[model samples]
Target: MHEVSICEALLDQLTSLAAQQGWPRLRRVWVRLGLLSGVVPDALEFAFAAMATGTPAEGAELLLENEPGHFDCAVCGELELERMDFTCPQCGGALQLLRAGRDLWLSGVEPMPS
Candidate 1:
């Protein structure tokens, strides 16, 4: 799966950040996973665990925070959709996507105790 590649990139970023910030070991990695990002959480976690071997991030907990898809309706202002639906419930107007839930980013990190 592409999650492996994603994890590789994530690890690269983590490595750079750790060196820049002088973190010896990482304890936790926090990520924001959008609902429609097409990346499976389980797959990502598995990839991370597999790829993190012998690295500073080994044994690090990968925490995911889900971000819901958001839309803007002419009549409803804003709406949060759990699934794909382009119609506004209130006025049946066409909903415009404000956030497509395609965001994937590292939000925070926790380092091991010195």
Candidate 2:
């Protein structure tokens, strides 16, 4: 799945960071995932484990923090908490996604020196 590609990308980033800092190993990785980011946590974990084999992050723990989606209504000037779709419940107006839940970010990383 796409999670595999995502995991590979994450590992690349981690490796680059570790190299930049002259770190020998990665201990943990904290990721911020949007709720509507269309990524399954379990799947991502699996992908990470699979891709990390023999890598610096082989046993690194992947911590995920979820962020909810938010929308703003143009007609009513109301900000709405959106769990799924882009419809404003308060004013029945077309909602504009202020922050669409489509972020996969590396928040922090713990590295171990050689």
Write candidate 1's Cα lDDT for 1-107 as tens digits. Answer: 77988899899999999989999889999998887778889999999999988778999999988877889998879988766778987899999888776758999
lDDT of 2 by residue, 1-114 (tens): 978888989999988888898877898889988766788899999999888887778889999887766677887774646366567788777887776668699999998645
Top candidate, metric TM-score: 1
Model 1 residue 45 lDDT score:
95
Q: Quote the RMSD, in angstroms, for model 2.
A: 3.4
Kindly provide the TM-score of model 1 when superposed on the true structure, using C-alpha atoms. 0.80
> lDDT of each model, Cα atoms only?
0.88, 0.82
**C-alpha lDDT (0 to 100) for residue 9 of candidate 2:** 90
Worst 10 residues of 1 by lDDT: 96-105
